[model samples]
Target: SGSRAVTIDTTPPGAPVITSVMDNMGTVTGDIANGGRTDDTTPTLNGTAEANSIVRVYNGTTLLGSVQASGTGAWSYTPTA
Candidate 1:
């Protein structure tokens, strides 16, 4: 009989931080901060996560989209709807 060893990764990635949310599709194109508003339907989201990891964006439990983080742990996404 032969025995085999298996390895598993249990470490979790760092928490993602949303740096900015920009509205580039509307007349007021800029970062929406401090409880600001925008007419743009598809605002761009910029953030950082674990390097080379998958970042998922959600809105009230509904997933908008997913984007892979860069080698530097940076990621961005813009939803179509």
Candidate 2:
């Protein structure tokens, strides 16, 4: 006789919210407005997601990068290019 235990999660995490986008490479570094423009090549993105979840950042259809959310559900990502 053999026994095994397994666990499954069906509930999905809440949608991520982009709190702010900062131009780290710009001469005048600051947060970029919702529809604003920037000359920064590698901007920093701040957001929130489910704790310990994988947060993926994308540009239109292209995947930029992925980061793990902190225990408080906070995450940040900066594109390399």
- Report the C-alpha displacement of residue 52, candidate 1, in angstroms: 0.4
lDDT of each candidate versus the true structure: 0.90, 0.90
RMSD of each: 2.9, 2.9
* Residue 6 displacement (Å), model 2: 11
Kindly give the stretch of ten consecutive residues in candidate 2 with the minimal lDDT sum: 21-30
lDDT of 2 by residue, 1-81 (tens): 899898899888788889999997757879999998899988899999998889988889898889999999999998897
Error of 2 at 4 (Å): 14
Cand. 1 Cα-lDDT: 0.90
The TM-scores of all predictions, comma-separated, are 0.81, 0.82
Candidate 2, residue 67: Cα displacement in angstroms equals 0.4
Residue 73 deviation, candidate 2, in Å? Answer: 0.4
Off by over 4 Å in 2: 1-9
Cα shift from native, residue 33, model 1 (Å): 0.7
Total backbone collisions for each predicted model: 0, 0
